[model samples]
Target: MRTIHAPRLLLLLGTSLVVRFGQTLRSEDRERGDVPGWVMITLMSATLVAFILVMAQGALESMFNAAMEKVNP
Candidate 1:
């Protein structure tokens, strides 16, 4: 009786701990901590790309056309 009860008690405790840990993880996931970081990175990358294109539109077009001609022909 004691052995059976002890195993069952430990299993119940372990199950409760696992449930609590899972709840903590879920709550943490609801917070968008890194979303702003990602947004900033995306905006900065887009701005950089726009700046580069504005500065070198002709050069990039010529490079792209040359590469395509080499690949297809």
Candidate 2:
């Protein structure tokens, strides 16, 4: 009898489960009549912009402070 490759078998099983989960999510979204493409795109874009702004907040504050100090001196 041949020995089983446990690691390879587990990896294949995990991949299959993930694919099936994605398919199920897609089907549910279709059934729910999900939001339109344009709306989704707008929402995603806004989220990205918000994230960028948040990440840059500290840098913006430092730049503003530097400019003010120069102007006041």
Residues 3-65 of candidate 1 have per-residue lDDT tens digits of 545445545554555565455556646676765545545555555566566668899999999
Prediction RMSDs, each to the true structure: 21.2, 13.1
lDDT of 1 at 37: 49
- Candidate 2: C-alpha RMSD after superposition: 13.1
TM-score winner among the candidates?
A: 1
Worst 10 residues of 1 by lDDT: 1-10
Task: Report the poorest 10 consecutive residues by lDDT, candidate 2.
Answer: 31-40
> Which residue pairs collide, candidate 1?
none
Highest-lDDT candidate? 1
Give the per-residue lDDT digits (tens) of candidate 2, residues 1-73. 8765644544555455556545655664665453454444555455556655666879989999999999995
What lDDT score is found at residue 58 in candidate 2? 92
Candidate 1 RMSD to the correct structure? 21.2
